[model samples]
Target: MKNLIILSIAGFLLGGCTTGTSITKEGTTNDPKWHKVETILNKDQGTFPNLQSLSEVRQGMTKDQLYSLIGRPHYDDGWRPREWNYLFHFTTPGQGENDITTCQFKVIFDHNMIASSFYWNPINPKNGVCPPNIQHKQIANKRYTLSVDALFTFDKYDIENLNTKGKEDLDSLVRELGKFKELNTIQIVGYTDRLGTQDYNEKLSYNRAQTIKQYLTLKGIPSQIINTIAKGSEDAVKECQGISEKKQLIDCLAPNRRVIVDVDGYIEGTPENNPAIK
Candidate 1:
C-alpha cells in the first residue's frame, strides 16, 4: 500500500508538469507559454532600444521593417519561424542608475509573413503595456554644423585655438544636450577644403575632431559615447572648381571646412511640449 501511494504521488506531479506546457495551444505565439526565457539561446543581448522606435512597431510590419526599427532578435530562432523573440532592458523607475528591468518581447507573424500580434513577459495587467519608463516618447536627432573658420584660427586645430564665438556656440550646445533623456552617441565628423595634401588634410581634420571631443568632454559629456571621424576633403558641400582667385575659392569652400556634430537620443514630452522643438 505504501509503494502504491508513492507511485500515485509521482504520477500526479508528472501530470501537473505536463499540464503546464499544455496551458496554451501550440503555434500560439501571442501567449507567454509559447516561449520560455530559458529557451533563448542568445539571451540578454538586447539593450536599451529607442523608445520611439519601440512604439513604432505595429501589426502587419514585415521582418525587415522590424529589423530596421529595433534591430534583430536576440535569439537564434530561424528567420522563417512564425515568431521572433527579443530581450530588452529598460530603466527601472525611481531606482539607481544601474538598476534595469529586463523584459521579453515576442512578435507573432500571420500566414502571409506579417506581424499580427506582440507580447511582453512577464505580462503587465493592462493589455499592450510596455516595460517601465517606456512610454510612447518622442525621439529626435540633433545636428549642429560649426565652421572651422569660426572655431579656430586658420589651420589651427587645438582647444586653445577655439575663439570667443566658438566657445559661446559650444556652450549653447551643451545646454541643448541637457534636454535629452538617454543620449546614445555623439558623432563629430571633421572636413576640410580640398586645397591641402591628403596627409595634411587628414591630420588637420582629425585634430579638429579631437579638439571638439575634448571640449565636449570638459563640458561634462561622457567621452566613451563620443566618436570622432576625419573625412578630409570628402563629401564636400561646396566645390570651388575653376575659381582663379584665392579669396573667392576660400569663401566658396567655407561650407566644406566645417565640423558636423550629430546627437542621437530620446527626449521627454511631445514636440509641442518640448521647448527645444520650439
Candidate 2:
C-alpha cells in the first residue's frame, strides 16, 4: 500500500510540472490559453514605435539591434530564450482621436541568436493584416526653423530665458504636432554663430537644444522620440568674412544662430491622397 502511494505521488508531481507555462512547439510564449495579462510589464500601456523603425525591422538582425529599434519584450520569456514578444499600439485611420488598435508582435530567433521570423496576431479581416495603416501611407517630414534671437537673449540657453515670442513659436509647434496621430521622431538641431571659443560654442548649442527638448516634453511630447544635436559654428548659411565690427558680424551670422526642428510622422492614405500635403 505504501508503494502504491509513492506511485500516485509521482504522477501528481509530473502533472503539476506539465501545467507550468512554457514555450509552445510553434515557439510562441504568449499563448492566450496559458499567458496571463499581468505578466506583461507594459500591460495596457503598450509601446508606440515609430512607423519607419517598424518598417526597418528585417530578418537576421541581432538581439541588440532589435532591442534598439522596438525595445525589449513586454514580458520575460526566460534566460537566453528564442522568442521575444511585444505589445504595440497604433492609431486607426478614420477613427476617433481616442481610438487605437493594439497588436501583439512576436519575433523568433534562430540558433545563432538572430531574429528570423516575425508574426503579428489578432488580425483584422477588414484591415487585411496585423499592422494596419503602415502600407500605402507616407510619412510627412516637416522642418521648422526658429531663430535664436527670437527664442532667447544673447548667450542664454535655458527655458527661463525663453522670450515671449519663443513661447508662442513653440506653442504653435506643439499644435502642428497635434495634427498627426502617430509621430515617428522629432529631431532638434541647435546651431550657434562663430563668436565664442569652439568648446564654448558647442556647449552653448547643446544646452540650447536640451532646453528645447525640455520645453517640448513639458508640452506633452514623448521624451523617447526626441533627439538633439549640436552644430556650433558649422554649416553656416551666411559668412561675414570682411565684417570686423562685433555687431555687424553677429547680425550677418543671424541665420546661423537658429534651431531647426524636423518632425517625421505618418498621415492617413497615400502621399497623393494625403490632405496634409495638398
Pick by TM-score: which candidate is best?
A: 1
Question: Model 2: residues >4 Å from true position, as ranges?
Answer: 1-50, 53-137, 271-278
Q: How far is 18's C-alpha from truth in model 2 (Å)?
A: 26
Clashing pairs in 2: none
| Backbone-clash count (model 2) | 0
The RMSD of every model to the true structure, in order and in angstroms, is 9.4, 8.7
lDDT of 1: 0.71
Q: For residues 63-153, what per-residue lDDT tens digits would candidate 2 score against the true structure?
A: 9998888889886665666777776766564442344555667777666777766766542232434575666677677899999989999
lDDT of 2: 0.74
Candidate 1: TM-score? 0.67
Stretches of candidate 1 exceeding 4 Å from the true structure? 1-52, 86-105, 120-132, 198-203, 245-247, 270-278
Residues 1-278, candidate 1, lDDT per residue (tens digit)?
99999998876654432212121222343234434545556654555666557767877689899899888876654436566777766544334334445667777667677776666663222232355544434567889999899888888999998999889888888888878876656889999999889989989999999999999999988775688999999999988799989989988999999999988766775543321111
- lDDT of all predictions, in order shown? 0.71, 0.74
